[model samples]
Target: MQKTLSTLTNNWAPSSLSQKVFLAQQVREHEAAAAQPCGFSMYMLMQRAGRGVFGHLKATYPYAHNILVLVGVGNNAGDGYVVATLAKSFGWQVTVAALNPHKVLSGDADTAQQAWIAEGGTIRPWQDIDFKNFDVIVDGILGTGLKGQVRKDASELICALNKTDLPVLSIDVPSGLDSDTGVPLGICVHADCTVTLVAKKQGMHTGQGKTYTGKLIYDDLDIALTFNKIAQPSAYLVSYDQLPKLEKRQANAHKGNFGRLLTLGANAGMPGSLRLTSEAALRTGAALVRAYCHTDSRLSISIGRPELMLTSDGLSAQLAWSTCLAIGPGLGTDKWATKLFNETMAHIESEQKTCVIDADGLNLLAESQHAFSTIFSPKHCVITPHPGEAARLLGCDVPDIEQDRLKAAQSLAKHYNAVCVLKGAGSIISNGEQSWICTDGNPGMATAGMGDTLTGIIAALLAQGMSATDAALYGVCLHGAAADIIAQQYGQRGMLASDLFEPLRVLVNPT
Candidate 1:
């Protein structure tokens, strides 16, 4: 039997709703086919979309009586018309401002437009309207089909709407924003709230998308299950709920059972980075953490952390003793740092041990001429690189890396044959076959030593027997969630990297 929309949604799991993310093309191409399984046509889907937006707006702004619906020549305009018709029916003062007042819409869009006109709704050119007179603006100027830069007329209309202080509600997607990459095509509508239909787009949850898409509300329209069955998601959006839980310790479990992590770095003048990494590893439940640094760094790195086994000699012995390795926190590119890095890489490759390479280690690897496969195996290696380091490793510019972070992370993982955590606003974790975006961090985590702390956390998870991909996924989400907790309490400014330790510990041992 064909299930009803309410029946499907009632059984939908919250975790699945929040976590699955798809590409713009996937949704555009598959939505109609997906709707069919639920006995809905494209026009029926459009009607539901319009109804959802209007219902949400009514609930959100109970007193908002006057509204301006700005629309362009596309299916998006059809959605706007539907909203306008619904508003007029409800006795609210509504105006439909068309970017092209004379242009005709077709198919499902045409049906929606005709219905609005039949209901005695009028359409005016967008330029003729005074935006200040309206209580709210409904943005239906463009949809997910947006290609390249926005045209001048549409761009000017979007700019005018943005200039207004009145709240704006966007349907499908904020016009001018790339639904796939989350980047703006020149200028995008800065909506106060966006009601995205169908499945969640990857772009909406990351990068500049977050800035443009204010409070996001998803209406699957009861077809997400059918859509998901037809298409695989580009990436999963991970949060605290999706993190891998650590197994409870046995009463007889000893320190050795938890695993040891060896963290290398802190050459001469840069002791704090090493300290942050080593301490983070400890806080993340590494049974024992050993810090191998330059002789001058030993005292400073171990000053407050007596539990850390510090050493300046016997690199081979330290590497042998630890279950996993985290390299590159304060590791410089000088000859001494290079020698240690090379030796460690050689040891890791030869022993086939699990490892994390971050910061300077990534920088050094970028400089190395050796093939990535010769140095690291995908099964046991994870690389965490911010945009700058990722650009260096990928031989590209920072803008190029940020252009499509998902692609950049996947490229790094494929090129290096290891799990890649491309760190930034939606830190991406990709292992070629699967990808995830960490949606928990804040801008406050931009401070120094943050990457170092992340390196330690991932290393600890790896040492404790998580797979390379699982460790990176869990570590990145945990790192960001911890930062969010701190930002809520202390605010983002002046938030130190070390501030995450308490929350990190608390989060990893989730109740």
Candidate 2:
């Protein structure tokens, strides 16, 4: 269950029927494996699925006076018939683009089709109708059963669909898009909103799926089925606007009220890394921040920023005071870095200090595999690893992790019993038992030291008493929001991580 967040639906997004069927199979598999049976019947499940999808559409396009639903020969067409009939019964102008050329539909699909016709529904094909005349198109053609490239007729239909600027509400995933992959089957509908039933499909998160499935949304469809073997989710998306607000501060609050942030790294020429983290923490409202850097960088760091109590290769002065530690930004992974990382990890673990590890620190962990467990316990740690670092942690290649970020993030979190933020576009955040995908941040954040900024931001929020879950949500959002502001000032290409500090300050406490 989500942590104190509102339901997944904020602005509703509907999905395709293929996705619904996939969820059914998933539920069935869960029942077969988990020993708990879903109390609902299959037909009842289908009914809920149809109604839930319809409900979202009605809510989304409430202003549309006329709704045109395109129905095919499959069960998806049956769903369309259901919606169209409902709309017509409610006295709206409804038309059906019946692509079922032959008079041959079966099962529940045929039953629904006949009922629509009996109630005076009109039908036509692409050749016979001007699709643009409709305000909205309900695509129920060719559901998830479609595996190969779309046929000529379907492609023509899809092309016709593309020609119209009219918004489309797809039932059970978009037509011509693979429910599991989102790649167009040589043709696909560009839906404005997709209504998905039961559970979401894997294809919605990665690759081209995000484009086809505009605004990924979910609906349980009132199918109260017990599931045992929940397929590992493929990816995650951070829900928006449901983030927790900071606790109210008392007028008597002092420096001690905010947590202390400890940052390690900044080897010589790379003072930029340590500075970014320290600056970010302070700017993001950390009460106190201290940076431990190379002797060569100490003078420069101190000169550039008087706020930081910079020390050369000495963390003992700050370690005892820090509530959360951020390590590895600009920390080279050479002999010097290895020694520093090992020493810090050991001290943090032995002293029971809460910590975050990132950049070369993760690389160091990979280098000294056994040292990780020795230095940090599961609960007091968070690791921000990009694909390469994640691969190193798992002893695999980056491609394997990218193939499934959700699994990769989970594995890293579970193995260490630590919060793992898999850095990159659509970042995966997990604490082994639970996980999330960041829905914010743009390409401007691809610049250097961004990860370091995130490390400090997370540390700062944690020090501020946000639980790991809320801390992550707040940190990621704040980090992205800061980056966005910088991007606005310097353009995405010129926005550096350091540029984020001031923006972070504004976002943390605008008042």
Top TM-score: which candidate number?
Answer: 1
Tens-place lDDT per residue, model 1, 194-307, is 999999999888777888998889989888778877877888888765554556655676678767789999999999998999999999888889999999998899787899
Question: How close is every model to the real structure, measured as TM-score?
Answer: 0.94, 0.71
Shift in Å, residue 509, candidate 2: 5.4
lDDT of 2: 0.72
Locate the minimum summed-lDDT window of 10 residues in model 2.
1-10
Score candidate 1 by TM-score against the native: 0.94
Q: Which sections of candidate 1 miss by over 4 Å?
A: 1-18
Clashes of each: 0, 16
